[model samples]
Target: MARALPLFGLVLLASGGLMGCGERTAARAALSPPDRAEYMGIETQLLDASTVSFIVRMRGARDRSDVVAYARCAAAQYTVIRGYSFAQHVRTNVRRSGEIWEGDGGFVISPDLPAGRRNLDAEVIVDDCREQGIPTV
Candidate 1:
């Protein structure tokens, strides 16, 4: 009876493993990893003395988060361009048309660090962006 039980368990396990092998392999092959983000370009607009708007476009983004990141990188670099050391994120609007993703981000540039959780030190962010292979304005 013990030998029969072991043989039955092995048969069940083997059948289970074989049953879905073809389908599982096909599904995995069909589901390829998303392509890496391709940054298209960036446009910077100064809204006010302390406020700015960044319009960023990219391709191959997996989601809106990539768009936001691209915009943030632009804002960080623009802050440095204006001789500012910090930037606060106000908001970002994201949209996609076909393969191109666009993000319009609002940021406040400051010589001093802003009092917000969404704020970033311009120099640090630029370095991080570069490390991540993301471009800056």
Candidate 2:
């Protein structure tokens, strides 16, 4: 019985780890990096009810012409969006073709970020984008 219990525990841990890994892979797949820079429109709307809204539009990097996909704000950094502080989540929507990923709102915009592009945790950011209909890179 003791041996069986240990084996079961090991199996449980393994399965949990595998599940986490799967989630990471799926998130990465959704936000696979683009070959070239992509231009995404960012709009921050202050809701009348004291909540802020976000709108993201994706378009070709070279063309400042029109938008391709639209994403509405579903979530925020839980702090910055609320005007609590500046060093909070600063997420943006990234998209290539139909693929999408949500940039993490918590990351500070580095000068190296391509024009408007940001660096973020791929998995968490992508998942948030997917859930909120945001785009991904």
TM-score for all models, in order of appearance: 0.73, 0.31
Instruction: Give the poorly placed runs of model 1, Cα more than 4 Å off.
Output: 1-35
Candidate with best TM-score: 1
Task: Give the poorly placed runs of model 2, Cα more than 4 Å off.
Answer: 1-23, 60-78, 81-137
lDDT per residue for candidate 1 within 51-97, as digits (tens), equals 99999999998887678778888998999999998888899999999
lDDT (CA) per prediction = 0.75, 0.34
Candidate 2 clash figure, as a count: 9
Candidate 2: which pairs clash?
89-105, 89-106, 90-105, 91-105, 94-136, 95-136, 100-136, 101-135, 101-136
What would the per-residue lDDT of candidate 2 be over residues 1-137, giving only the tens digit for each residue?
22221211222342454346566566444333333534365555554433334554443333211121122122323222343321112434444454433331223322122222222222333344455344432
